[model samples]
Target: MAKTRRVSEEIVCAAIRKRKKRTHVPEADAPKAGEPRSFVIRRGKYAPMLKDLEKDLRQMMMPNTAKELKESRKNVLKDFVQVAGPLGVTHFLMLSATQRAGYLHVAKTPRGPTLTLRVLEYSLMRDVQSAQQRPRCPQTMWHGPPLVVLNNFTGSEHLKLAATTFQNLFPAINVATTKLSTCQRVLLLDHDRASGRIRLRQYSIVVQPSGVTKNLKALLGRRAVPDLGECKDVSEFLTRSGYGSESEGDDPDTTRVELAEDLGKGNQKARQSRIRLHEVGPRLEMELIKVQDGLCEGNVLFHAYIQKDPAEIAERKSKEDEREALRRQRRAEQEENVRKKESEAKRRRRPQDDARGAKRPRPEGRVPWG
Candidate 1:
């Protein structure tokens, strides 16, 4: 039998010549559902599949939806608590429906775009200038007309907020629009020409309104009516009376920290958790936390999950590395000194040739007669 011929270089070169992209067998080119079909790449055309794949990827990654849900279910307290830290009970306890929606969305919840209990306008309504012309607040089912409520709430300047708000700010049943609080119903500005002094006088507003008969007492006192808290879709803010500037104050950045903690500690143990491993600074910044973000999950576990005080950690690490370098430099210096001593000793043991070390000293080496 004739021996098998060896493949020649020209034949091998022709075989190795680049083929058209279409002919090249791709690893896996199965078109998934909702994917576009592959196209012919001719005349050095750019690969169309890459753009499609990239577009598909972009459509796939939603920035916050999943993360928000995972975070909010547990981190709700951390978020609200940090909010509460700055606001008073009245301000903190209450949030308008719109505001509440914003908070939930900020915390990454999908409460909105569903049942939009949007509060058009929310505040104390104090005036009913005319029966014909009255301010109407759209939110009537729960709050009635704010003017009526303000009539019930607005007391003289000196009186405490709680006492005045309950007495004057109480809603009147005569909100024909169920929107405007008529002046008689909410505003308590009574003028008397009989006493001719241009002065504003304080009125008697009661805090412990015991023994007084209210127009709505029958409905209010009834146990079946349920507290305002139980009112469906009612904002807790409408119930509270007063607020102050001190409600907003210097507060720590507890949102990120608490959120990280709650998700880690609660019953839901995500794939990763943030736990303190060591302390770096005066605050709890140095302690290592297992970052829950998807990007940090794989190779970065041992790399130190640092979100806070990064500058400080970097500076400290830099100093440490520098110290090590300095130590190494000192060690090298000592080694050089030892080598020098050895060389000097060897030089001392070696004999020197004569005629003053051969062909006389160089002129540059000679010293002038002093």
Candidate 2:
């Protein structure tokens, strides 16, 4: 046998390094002609305004920021409601940011890009000026045109920022104003009122500083009741007309009668009732029902009644019953047919099986061959 020579580790490593050094590898270079290169394209002008908008968006998306925004909006709406309540403005329609954006209309004007905002104008029957004599009971009709609000938002420092933005995007449809003022004070008002068209009322908003104590002289003095229970408080706001408990003052004859003996007793499930005396307070007592010249009693505006003939209903019921009975009868007949077919198949197969068994040859007796 020839003696095999064992290669040393250093010799093998040197041979691998020599081979690697001699090997030719390709290099990664820039793309040549006709080669595709990745590139990005951006639309619109990318300026400081875009940066500011992006920054505001990021701030709005931050944690707790969205909640704070919602709370702020609620407070703003509540303030509006409070201010409008005394102004005889009972209804309000608040549009969301998306809705406001959808209604935005842009038109090129000589001055610049003018913003027109369309807002609902509420006109009460009382506000309508008629030449005819007022009836004893006037029928209050509520209908108003869509108010048109115009603004440039150039110098909107004193104006409400949100309202200014809203008006810029969503303008009113109709132009109506109580009086004529300067062009700056009114919407679309020009030097020549006769020749000027598209003139509308300029929208103005004033947010009063909260927490300012009103003058005591302006308000009437009244006694204060610390506890709500001590005062007889009743609300006219109820789900149904005759649902709420009658006020003791409204109906002095109204009385509470307990049907169960357990009632008014100190039982676990008993309802406790007591004849208590309390004074009415101004704060707790609210007059929900208003009395106005055109106002009417009752809150129901529209009612619908659906009537059906008894004979038709009875016919429909009878048809349904007949359908159900027919379905049951059909199901029973199908089951009986299936059972009969199975029995007939079994009877026919039994005789054939017996004949086949008889035809089979019996095993011959084995003959022993000694």
Candidate 3:
């Protein structure tokens, strides 16, 4: 009996240890302090194109952003901004459209400095996939955020601000601890210096075994049993040039790299792997229209088309200040009026309250036995 009890206790302890190990979260996976979380939402009337673009943007900002956030025409920017504070949402990507064009607003939460970009052209994910012969979108591709890559953003002041805003939209990665497996996607923002336009491309990072023939890879890593009826022997099938021969025949020196860690199936550490970026949908060509001092409002810091002189800027600032002062005065007067109304109401109720508390006249009737 004692031996059985001891065995049971040991089993219990082992199970507890296993549970603890399973529950432990690595430091790299834990939410970092001041990490940016985002909300990609649409405002105003629904545009069919904008709806799909919003979905793509949400997918691009995976894990750290709300994917299924619902918005209606009745919902205003203030509604989202008000809730953003308590929920720790640090950025907002608001998509809206007019009859003329669509706009993407990237704004910092609870503060100023919003970047507005006009969408010149866009391609949905479905459209992109339709054009490709084989689109590589894995089920777990969006399990983590995409790595942001900025190109040619060093030209002007506005471009610098835009780049900063774009960078903060995703959480920062630590080079020392970040795993290669988690980097399944890439968000490339390429800016054209002459055209002043930005091209947004989303790609999946594909790592395949290097120095392996296409036929051999297919035989080893076949998802389903590939038809073997074409050849009498397996060697014949392996030696034959297949449909995707051009990809396999390319020089591997340019794209091949030594893997630092184990990534994906058969991509082991210290092994040579070919890294390829496959464009996975939702391309956008946009131009920075303006940068504003506030969320979707306030003084324009940069405008692509409009340039104001110093005197004009000064006059605009003075006018804004006067308008703000007037608004404050009106608010103060309204508060005073409300306070007076409350006081008058209290004064009127005071006598009635006192009368109720006072003793009624017991005089009319004769008193009796005590």
Candidate 3, residues 63-100, lDDT tens digits: the string is 77778788777878889989999879999988888899
lDDT of 3: 0.86
Q: Considering TM-score, which of the candidate structures 1 and 2 is the better prediction for this target?
A: 2
Model 2 spans with C-alpha error above 4 angstroms: 1-306, 359-370
For model 2, residues 184-301, the per-residue Cα lDDT tens digits are: 1112311122322222222221111112222211111124522335335432222224333333233132222222333211211223222222111001011111111111212221
Best by TM-score: 3
Worst 10-residue stretch by lDDT in candidate 2? 279-288
lDDT of 2: 0.29
The local lDDT score (0 to 100) that residue 94 gets in candidate 1 is 13
lDDT string for model 1 (266-352, tens) is 212222212221111111001111211121121221122244466866786688689889999999999999999999987876655
Off by over 4 Å in 3: 1-33, 45-49, 223-248, 330-370
RMSD after CA superposition, every candidate: 31.8, 32.9, 8.0
lDDT of 2 at 156: 27
Candidate closer to the true structure by lDDT (higher is better), 1 or 2: 2
Better of 2 and 3 by lDDT: 3
Error of 3 at 126 (Å): 0.5
- Estimate the TM-score of every prediction: 0.14, 0.18, 0.77
